[model samples]
Target: MISAQSLTKRFGSLTAVDAVSFEVGTGGVLGFIGPNGAGKTTTMRMLTGFLPASGGKAVVAGHDVFDEPMQVRRKVGYLPETPPLYRELSIGDYLRFVAEIRGIAARDRARRVGEVMEQVGLSGWERRIVGSLSKGYRQRVGLAQAIMHDPPVLILDEPTSGLDPAQVAGMRDFVRELANDRTVILSTHILSEVELLCPRVVMIAGGKKVADGTLDEVRHRATGGVRYRVELKGEPPDAIAPAVGALPQVDQVKPVPRPPGDGPHDPWDQGFRVLDVRAADDPRTAIARLATEQGWTLRGMERRVPGLEEAFLAIIGAEQ
Candidate 1:
């Protein structure tokens, strides 16, 4: 439903976005993420036809963003980082204005406005002046305007910004429902939101595409290899570390230090040592067998996978 091919944007002598490319299939939700000055907003603008790309191409809902700007705009619903609002207008008036400008027929404008208002939790708030609403309410108004036209594709930039915990959850659920039939590009700094809402991620850094893949694939790429957390109680703490490291299935082992006041206090946890084990393949079976032969008590053994935050830091840190 959306495709960017070597999309580049320049401002005078500076290039804001450099040859960034990715794709989102129909009914797909793609997470677009990067740090400050990473050109995430610039890319979104080009895709939505809000800003023209200096080089390359962008297609949205089967329309070329540069050649068919009007068609792309008609099919895309964009909510920028800041909710664009006219402070002087009342909530109902502002949304009605948006509906009219979006080409909603006069006969359907009222129903469209009411449905979007309720979708964004703005029901019965038509009389409230936009200027009088809080920051969270302003965001809701922005979302309502974006969806009022019921476009086939939605490009949301920080859709959950300024929202409280409950509002954030509701926004996530709403986006998930929208993805059942429409394509979505969710751009945000919140990695946890991406994990919950996006199955695939496109990460850019320094205005360049750095990583693009499924969540698990990106995590594996960032970590280099698989790792495990093994806790065991053995005859000697010092011997256990070297013994685990000496195993053919294990490549490296590092002992993890317990926190100052967070040591295990349970009787079952006594004498258990923790170590991070990295290997090409699963080493739990080997470690468990070794513990049994050595008469050591095995507390727990589990595979450890890097979370999105960890993967983000690792990838961005290397790029720098």
Candidate 2:
């Protein structure tokens, strides 16, 4: 429901966002990730028509952001890093104000406000003064205002920032529920949040698009081949390394000391033998067969995959 092509934004001599381009389909949740000063906010602002792009174009829900900014604004619900809130207003009053400004039908404004409040878990707290609420509650109030008009596209910047662990979980669940039919573009530095909430991610570094794809696809670009951790009994890790390295699929093997309290006589009689195996393909079968032939019992074997954090670090590191 959102598309951008060769979008660029410059502030004087500084380029806040380069020629970054991506698209979000209907009901798609695109996680936007980058470090501080990476221009994530600048890009979002340009997409939402809050800021003009130096070059290129963006379309929101079929409306050109620059040419038809009013229409684009009508279809998009945006919550920036700081909740644009009036501390003096009560929750109910603030949301009603937002509804009126967004041109919600006067007859349906109350119902819409109530529905969004309930959606964000702020039900029955409408009378409370927004300034008096805690950070979590205030965030819920901000979310309620954003969805008060029921826009088809929601652009949330750091939607769960500054919340306690419990609050963060609650907010994540709420955002997932919000995405049932609407398209969402959320920018966050929290990798775990992206892993739990986004189906696809668009990573940026140095104001440029660095990666865009499903989690596994991005990870594959960061790591070469598969990795495994294997533990063998009856042999020191130093002695087992060269033997395992001889297997055709095995690329490299390094021995690491076993953790405390997990030693030999713990079923597989494990001592300090731990092998870090990098292989082109699944070599567990070959390694197991080799262990069997050598009379060494296999204690533990596990595959390791590069996670989103690793993928993110790899991408940003290369850029630097």
Candidate 3:
């Protein structure tokens, strides 16, 4: 539904976005993440046709963002980081204005406005003045206005920024619900939001595309190797490390000391005697069989995939 090829943007002497490229499929949610001054907003603006790229190309819903900007705008709904709102207007009036500006038919505009308001949890508050609404409700009003046209692609910048915890959770759920049938590309620095709502992520640093993939795929690429935590009973971890390490797939096996207060009554159950295992391929089956033959009871074994936080740290740290 969205594609960009070496998209670049410049402002005077500075290049705001540098040769970034990615794609978002129908019904996909792509989280655009980066630190301050990382060009996430610039990329989104180019994709939405609000800002033209200085080089390369971007297409939205099969229309070239530069050449067919009007068509792209018609198919895309955008909410900037700071929403463009009419503070003095009532919520209903503001949305109606947006619908009309987007060229919605007069007959269908009211129905569409009501539906979007309800979808964003602003139903009964339409009569309330936009200026009088709280931050959360104003955000809802912004969301309602964005979707009032029922565009196929939605681009939101910091959709949950500046909200309290409760408001953030509400906004997160709202974004998830919005992505049911439409493509969404949202820019945020919040890793937790990406973890909860996005299946794939595109990370930018120093105006360049640094990482792009599913959460686990990006994490794995950033971490450089796969890791696992293994536990065993009856035999001390030291007794099995060499055997496990000898497997063709195994790379390194380092014993993790048990936490304090763990006792020998049921040593494995007492606490996790973790074996930090790294490998070229999965070795759990081999390790399990070896444990059984050695009269050692298998307690637990699980892969430890890197999280988004770790992946972000690694990617940005390297760029610095």
Candidate 4:
């Protein structure tokens, strides 16, 4: 488990992280996201004891980050945006070094190193020099080192950065697997990856906490409310908007603009109009019934949940 209570970090007159607070349960991934320069890395550093907080407090695995830094470090596995690696050392030597420093017993170091290497898909890479590996392989090595001691908490900053599409997918799967037993704070710029891996999300912007909740809750808050897409073809295009808007279940309705060059006379256009309807509850059934009663041909109607990217922009854009 992890908790940040108004965690604040400052550099001279500038505040890198301003009283940001959130929590991650004992077992699951919590997506930590923000725009560039939003203080994501700063916050992670403070949580992992790599940087001291200028104000507020953080607790990791039930130990106060400030009071018991060594205990926190022992419980937390940190993978910064750039993996901390010694290029001159081969993968085996580097991980073995990490295992020893992390307090692994000398006799158990080899097995732990091998298990982590295999977990990160670097099983046979023991002899390869870390400096010679590609970006993807380097990331794997970084992850291997982070999990070498099998810490209960993982603070990963941009773990998939610089990885190709296939590598990104692989990393996502591995992170998901890791979340089975550990509490993970996953910070990344990739919103889609967060959507797939993190059921809960905490978004920061302008060095302050902007949003934090279950994925659906944050998206719903960012978008203002739930939405539905309704398409229909009928006699007076003007009547549809007013009729839908007048429905008690509908809070608002806006017509979707026709595509450019889509003329009224075009047969393919079918004189259909699309409306984005916003409401607190499902209105598709009512809308469909109304269309039938009004002799209008209902083309399609479906609920539309805003994507994480859309929600992210809406929240960050508002902060600006």
Candidate 5:
């Protein structure tokens, strides 16, 4: 439903977006994430036809974004980071104005506006002035306008920004509802939101595409291999690391810092030290045998999967 092929945008000496390309299937939700100045908004504006690209092309909802801008605009519903709203207008009036501009039929506009308002939890807020609404409510109003036309694709930048936890959750559910038939590209700094809503993610840094794939795929690629966390007692914390690192199966051993009395039965409290072991193979059996021979008490030995935050950090950090 959406495609970006080497999308490039430049302003004077700086390139805001550089040869970035990705795709989102019909009825799919893709999470776009990056640190500040990573070209997320620049790329999005070009895709929405709000800004022209310096080079390359984008197709949104099957319409060539550059060649057929009008058609692309008609099929895409874009909610920018800061919503375009008229504070003086009442919520209902503002929506009706949008409907008129989007060329919705007068007869169907009322029904459409009502449905969108209810869908975004604004059923009884039609008469309230847009300026008087709280930030969260205003966000809902922005969402309402974006979907009022019932467009086939949505480009939402920070849909849950300024929203409280409850509001954020509600907005997530509403976005899911919108995605039942429409393709969605959501850009946000919130990792948990991406984890909840998007199976695939595209991460960029320094205006370049850094990673793109299913969440697990990216995680594995960034971290390189599986890791195991080991907690052992009856040994000097300082001396145990070198011993573990010498094992044939172990490729890396990173110590997990535990301050005095910090964790459950804190290692320091019971003379145990915890370290994360990344090995060439499953080293549970070898670790157990080694510990038994040394008379060290094993408190915990568990395989650990690198988390999304870890993967995101590793990729973004490396790209920079």
Candidate 6:
């Protein structure tokens, strides 16, 4: 449903989106993420034909973004970071206007507007003034507008930026429902949202495409190998780190931050410390051997999978 090939956008000497490309098939949800000023907006604009790319090509719902902008616009529903709304207009009036602009037939505009408003939980809100609506309601109106035409693709930027937990959950559920048969590009800073909503992710930084893959693929690619969390009680507490570090198979050791209830006055908790060990190469056997030889009381040792947030930091941090 969406394709981008080396899409590049430049403003004077500044490159906003540089040779970036990715594809989202019909019914796919892709998480587009990056830090602020990372050109996510510029890229989305190019995809929506709101901004022209300097080089390369993009196709939305089978229409070339550069050559067939009108057709592309007709098939794409874009909700930008800020809800584009006319405060003076009532919700019903605003959505009707949107339906008209989206080319809904004159006779069908009212029914379409009402359906979309209801789909986005804006039922009975048509009489409410746009300016009088709360931020969450404004967002609902924005979403209603985007879907008024029932476009095949939805590009949402920070769709849940500001809302109570309940509102955020509602938005997430709505987006998921929308993606049942439509392509969606969800751009947000919330990694957890991506984790829940997107199976694939495309991350960009400094106008360059940094990573693109399923969440797990990107994580494993970033961290290189598996990590393990080891909690042990051993003699000479001060030598714990060195003892673990001396193991030939251990590549690196990181201290695990103490969690709540770890500082209680319990005798069993004495002389125990937790550490994260990054294996040099399959160090599980070596870890067990070292612990047994040293008479260390092994409380727990579990292999760990790197999360998206950890991978995000690793990839973004490396660019810095």
- Global lDDT of each candidate: 0.91, 0.88, 0.88, 0.92, 0.88, 0.88
Could you estimate the TM-score for every candidate?
0.88, 0.88, 0.82, 0.92, 0.89, 0.86
Clashes of each: 0, 4, 0, 0, 0, 0
Clashing pairs in 6: none
Ranked by TM-score, top first = 4, 5, 1, 2, 6, 3
Candidate 4 residues lying further than 4 Å off, grouped into runs, are 233-235, 257-272
| lDDT-best of 1 and 3 | 1
On residues 210-231, what C-alpha lDDT tens digit does candidate 2 reach at each position?
Answer: 9998877887787653689888
lDDT of 5 by residue, 91-185 (tens): 99999999999999999999988988888889988899999989998998888888878899999998887899999999888888778888999
For TM-score, candidate 1 versus 4, the one ahead is 4
Candidate 3's residue-wise lDDT over 1-320, tens digit each?
99999999999999999999998899968999999889999999999999989999999999999999999999999999988889999988999999999999999999998898889888788788889988888888888878888899999999898889999999988888889989999999999899999999999998999999998889888976678888875556466778878878789988876557745644445644568899868889988988888887778898877788888999999988
Which scores greater on TM-score, model 1 or model 3?
Answer: 1
Pairs clashing within candidate 5:
none
Q: Write the per-residue lDDT of candidate 1 for residues 149-251, one digit (tens) a residue.
A: 8889999998987889998998899899888888889898889999999999999998999999998889889986678988888887789999999999999
Q: Any residue pairs clashing in model 1, and if so which?
A: none
Please tell me which model should have the higher lDDT, number 4 or number 5.
Answer: 4
Indicate the worst ten consecutive residues by lDDT in candidate 4: 259-268
Listing every candidate in turn, what is its Cα RMSD in Å to the true structure after a full C-alpha superposition? Answer: 3.3, 3.7, 4.3, 2.4, 3.2, 4.1
Clashing residue pairs for model 3 = none
> Candidate 5's error at 2, in angstroms?
1.0
Flag regions of model 2 displaced more than 4 Å. Answer: 231-243, 246-274, 295-299
Candidate 6's TM-score reads 0.86
